[model samples]
Target: MEKTTSLISKKHYPILDGLRGVAAIMVVAFHIFEAHATSHLNQIINHGYLAVDFFFLLSGFVISYAYDDRWSKMTVTDFFKIRLIRLQPMVIMGMIIGAVCFYFQDSVLWPTIHEVPIWKMLVVMIIGFTLIPVSLSMDIRGWQEMHPLNGPGWSLFFEYIGNILYALFVRKFSNTALAILVFLSGCLLIHLAVTSPNGDVIGGWSLEPTQLHIGFSRLLFPFFGGLLLHRIVKLTTINNGFFWASLLTVIVLAMPRIGGSKHLWMNGLYDSLSIIIIFPLIVFLGASGEVTGKYSTKICKFLGDISYPIYITHYPLIYIYTGWAVGSKPSFQEALPFALLTLIGAILLAYTCLKLYDEPVRLWLKQKMLTYKPAFITVK
Candidate 1:
């Protein structure tokens, strides 16, 4: 018997990375505009919430591409450790940022924030570190968010669930079985989308039953669909894939709401079709293309690096922005400067976190946890 190591770094899809960054930036913009909108139909980036669904699809494709074949040499523990190192550091940082900014966000939007005990907020932060969602009864803020300190953590919670399902059950699924699962999940997604009262697939940050249904409905189709796609689709070369895909993504997310007050389901149908059809097409294009020049490559790299940090950490700042907007009730022109500042601030903070915290922490964790050899292993 010979000792062996199972840690091998897989090549990433750069265009996919860039697309992710594009979507993350759009989410920040969406949230910033959310402060002024009276309802979903009138929001600046009406379909920006679809970015989460796109992310789920990307995760599925990437996970399958990276790990589906590695189980032959990797233990379940190894897979989990790898995921934690990659994802958990920023999660902790996001929660901390949210906690630090919590009191500053006290306003008409979150009336109880100023009065909430510091100990209770700390408790929420600690639980947030583990990604275990708090109950509504425990909500310190008036908003019924599962992770009130950091609302984006809800998507991450579902992300963890997808990973667990993969390691424990879905990884073993044959392409046929996975296809069936994807089909069923897709149906559920479509049903939920078209029938939703708001005519969009938006509310998944809460822990209540309806939101949970929205959560799982939003999670399963795109995730497993991406997995199934990776299993089935053959690669083809596409020129300037990043530019085209990024353009298409921004267009879809920035599109105005389809239906007005009387035709809400029209918007829901649009959401379903975009998630089911358009997003995967974007992923396919992104995965197939190569970065052509030094300039484009650098742009992709920067966007990829800062995408997750911007997404996970920026919402705390949004909390402050929302507080101000609600209290002051400023016109769009009056609010423009602050909104732009918030966007710039979110990008800068995300970049700082990426350089100072996420990269170093992940590197250290990988060295400690993933770089090891088994003593009694047979080399095949």
Candidate 2:
């Protein structure tokens, strides 16, 4: 006789969830600040882009914790199904939101926005639904972003790559081999950060060779390093881990650019060190933490829930805000109220999608796709 088995749901690290929410909020602030600043060096929330790196670290750790031991029962197809159910609903909603708001974002900043036809925009939106990046030749926004409809979708593109890599090969590696790969990737990241003319790990949105290098460099080390960290380091209990970890996250992401224009490498060093050292520490702390009270637990739950929705959905609004700022040429003080409104509006919209669209769709997908019948084998 054979027995049927069901996969057990994994426990979540609430502190990590809370930290993710904190980082997501900072990303919104970073983009909002991007409208006022002329360049990377002068931008407020200077290191906010590093939130993406921090996210990758979190993703690797979470994925490992969730799936590493399940391969005995989980097929690759099942793994992809779970990821898609968890992630794709929001991605589709983000593209639809982008397409809906595309024309309204027309401004002198994006000169060709007015010239692009509706059908072309729809084509881009449809492509975006699939998350296969469009080449610059097809770019409608003039930003050369992989997904013109949703610019930040570029990171999701790399995110898919990471997932594929993990499912296919990295999942099978020994801890020692994994550590070697992580070390080499770390070197590449440091080299890219220090040597780039911009002096940061910022350029992963485009299709060009240089940008591709930056994208992979941004993706590899922290992701695999997080995996390595999971395999090697044992978790320890910590008091108030969420508060300290969140404080460190905010400080690292909000710090001023180091070295200025003359010593760009200093900022590069900061980026490298933050990714290679500080981000892992934050994850470790978060993983080791416990959500102590009802208030704290609820706060963590709310933030964690909205983190991805807000990050994926807010940029379309930012496009509109950027257009208004550029065409009106408003001072920072003049733009302040609108910026606050934009931030508030984004949070509201994200929450609405979470409740009305993402949750329902994901639930439906899980019911439809994930309800696989158990397979039984002959007893020995």
Put down candidate 2 lDDT per residue, 1-380, tens digits, no spaces. 33334765566688888899999999999999998888888999999999999999989888888778878888898878878877888888999999888866667877454689888999999999989999888798889899998999998888888899999999999998999999999999999999989899998999899999999999999888888888888999999999999999999999999999999999999999999999999999998989989999999888898999999999999999988988898988899999999999999999999999988997788667764322221000
Clashes of 2: 0
Candidate 2 ranges with C-alpha deviation above 4 Å: 1-5, 112-114, 372-380
26: Cα error in model 1, Å = 0.2
> What is the lDDT for 337 in model 1?
97
What TM-score should be assigned to candidate 1?
A: 0.95
Q: Write the per-residue lDDT of candidate 1 for residues 1-380, one digit (tens) a residue.
A: 34457555566688898899999999999999998999887999888999999999999998888778878788899878878887899999999999989866667777465589888999999999999999987798768999999999999999999999999999999999999999999999999988998888998899899999999999999999989999999989999999999999999999999979899889999999999999999999998999989999999988888999999999999999998998999998899999999999999999999999998997788767874432221110
In model 1, which regions exceed 4 Å deviation? 1-9, 112-114, 371-380
Which pairs clash inside model 1?
A: none
